[model samples]
Target: MGRILLFNKPFGVICQFSQDGLHPTLADYIPVPEFYPAGRLDTDSEGLLVLTDDGQLQHRITDPKHKLPKTYWVQVEGVPDSAALDALRAGVLLKDGMTQPAGAALIDTPPGLWPRTPPVRARKAIPTSWLELTIREGKNRQVRRMTAAVGFPTLRLIRYRIGAWTLDGLDQGTWKMNT
Candidate 1:
């Protein structure tokens, strides 16, 4: 086993340790050195990010062949119907290709959820809903693309779990060494 760190990444923060001169980078939140993110979370997304000092462990967490499940708490622009949920479960086709079938279900907004800075855009007329979506593949913007393809574009995306790790006790912009 190697040193493992679980970080609660904030939105608008880049995943890299180096400064980007624009958005805040991981360096701003985590001071630890020599640890690199095992996988990536987009600049617009938030939540659990795993970092490690071990190359083999990073590869295992990131390689698609390992198929570690990633779960997200997604807030979409509109309520998804059964058909939409089924589409997500069956796999949605994207410009890149068909995504692997995913686990999708309607979920109430997670308890103890931290509010996103510059909160998600709200239209009083169009209602929003949350879904717990889990995917085994890590395609670029796959979750957002899948929801958009299903006609309920994602308004907010927060990764809640990755494999056996989760954001349970971690707070936004904080990190902890995995015991």
Candidate 2:
């Protein structure tokens, strides 16, 4: 059986195992060799990231044809109204073209989230809200762009789940192996 590593990536950590020289990368957290990230999360994002050594498994995980669902807990600058949520469900137009329809809903910041090291800046006058967004496509920075398109700029983004795997209780910088 091929190996799978579920890493709860922290903010500022790059997805690659290579040395970036400026910031921490996956190599700092995982010493296992031969595994590659199935998908990517931006350096500014946090939470679940799947890695695998099997090329076919990796392709299935990241390929749009498989339609694996990815869920994110997004902290946005403003509360999204019904229209905004509907737009997300209906697919928002983006510079790359229209995104596939995604599941979007307001949620409380997931109950046991690890606090961000530097922390998202707080604006005293503008309130931020949490959104749970699930999308099938893995477009680069899609969640951030989608939220922004609907007038709610994402202040922080944490991916909570990918397919059937989840961060669940995995702490930041830690990883769990599966076969």
Candidate 3:
């Protein structure tokens, strides 16, 4: 069997193995050679990222046709009401087209959450809320667009789990091999 790695990527880290002159890349944290990212997370995003040495495993995880649901914990600009939740659950329209229906629910921020390095802009008038969203499709910036379409813009996006793998014990910029 080939090696598999689960990492809790921190904000500001690029998903690529090598940096293009500037900015930190996965190479700064993941030491495993010949392993490639199974999927991608934006530099501004954080949380679970998978790496694998097996090409087959890589395809299985990255291919949207396989329909492995990705779960995210999102902080948005406003409290989402039932209508907004329903809109998200029912599927929101994007520039690409209508998105697949999603599983979304209001959630409390877990205790002892580490703050983002450069925190989100504070607004005295607008409050924020956390939401858990699970989606089967992988579209570019889909989650951010979806929430905005439903009247709540995402303030922070963190992928907590992917398929059966999670970032449970992993800390920012740390990784562990799954035997």
**TM-scores for all candidates?**
0.99, 0.97, 0.97
Candidate 1 weakest lDDT stretch, 10 residues: 17-26
Q: Give the whole-model CA lDDT for all candidates, comma-separated.
A: 0.96, 0.94, 0.91
Misplaced by over 4 Å in model 3 are none
Tell me, by lDDT, which candidate is best: 1
Instruction: Using lDDT, rank the candidates from best to worst.
Output: 1, 2, 3
Poorly placed runs, candidate 1 (over 4 Å): none
Ranking by TM-score: 1, 2, 3
In candidate 3, which residue pairs get closer than 3 Å at backbone N, Cα or C atoms, i.e. clash?
none
Tens-digit lDDT track of model 3 for 45-154:
99999999999989989998899999999999989999999999999999889999999999999554678988988799999999999999999999999999999999
Candidate number of the best TM-score = 1
TM-score (C-alpha, index-matched) for candidate 2: 0.97
